[model samples]
Target: MKVFLWNETGKEKEIMLEDDQITVPADKGKYIYEVLAEWKNGEISYTFVAEVQ
Candidate 1:
């Protein structure tokens, strides 16, 4: 599984992780995050919005 994030005014950035958790440094704005899950069956994508301060 991989997570990607970006603000409404910029391109998406990939979030790297050493474990199940990862940290993202965001500026004050609205951001949208997407999770890409790769499985044996197929690939799945999930999206969510975040407000950063």
Candidate 2:
């Protein structure tokens, strides 16, 4: 499994996962993220938006 994040600047970055968990950015703003999982049989990916106040 892999995780990625994109901020308002449109720059994409990889986020390190600890124990299958991720820590969102501390900055107060909205961000986009993508989670990808792959296996021998098949693979899948999904995107979500997160807002931090």
Candidate 3:
């Protein structure tokens, strides 16, 4: 599995996972994220947006 994050400026960055967990950025703003899961038979992807205050 892999995870990535993108800011409003379109800057993409890879997120590191610790024990299947991740820490969101502290800056207050909106962000986009993409998650990819792969298997021997197939693969899947997902995207979503989040807002932080």
Candidate 4:
């Protein structure tokens, strides 16, 4: 269940990561593309990609 804190507000501390996904409090389906695009860097970062809904 690896997950990342996909917070739209850009607040890293507001994350609740797990496995394979992120713990976003809001409906991801509404902001998936935006978040992924804003955070995607293809580096060793723990947070790379994430689902919306």
Q: Which candidate is the best by TM-score?
A: 2
Pick the winner on TM-score between candidates 1 and 4. Answer: 1
RMSD of 2: 1.8
* lDDT value, residue 5 of candidate 1: 78
| Candidate models: Cα lDDT each | 0.77, 0.88, 0.83, 0.41
Model 2's TM-score against the true structure = 0.83
Cα lDDT of model 1 by residue, 1-53, tens digit: 98887666654688887678866556677668888899898999888877778
Tell me how many clashing residue pairs each candidate has. 0, 0, 0, 9
Using all chains and alpha carbons, the TM-scores for the candidates as numbered come to 0.67, 0.83, 0.81, 0.23
Per-residue C-alpha lDDT of model 2 across residues 1-53, encoded as one tens digit per residue: 99899766764888899999988878898889999999999999888988899
* Candidate 2: count of backbone clashes, pairs at least 3 residues apart or interchain: 0
Measured by TM-score, how close is model 1 to the native structure? 0.67
What would you estimate as the lDDT of candidate 1? 0.77
Q: Tell me which of candidates 1 and 3 scores higher on TM-score.
A: 3
- Weakest ten-residue segment in model 2 by summed lDDT: 6-15
TM-score of 3: 0.81
Q: Which parts of model 2 have CA positions greater than 4 angstroms off?
A: 7-11
Model 4 C-alpha lDDT per residue in residues 16-53, reported as the tens digit of each score: 44563455445555323122223355533344554456
Select the stronger candidate by TM-score from 1 and 2.
Answer: 2
**Candidate ordering by TM-score (highest first):** 2, 3, 1, 4
Error of 2 at 19 (Å): 0.9
Q: Candidate 4 versus the native: TM-score?
A: 0.23
Q: Quote the positional error of residue 10 for candidate 2 in Å.
A: 5.7
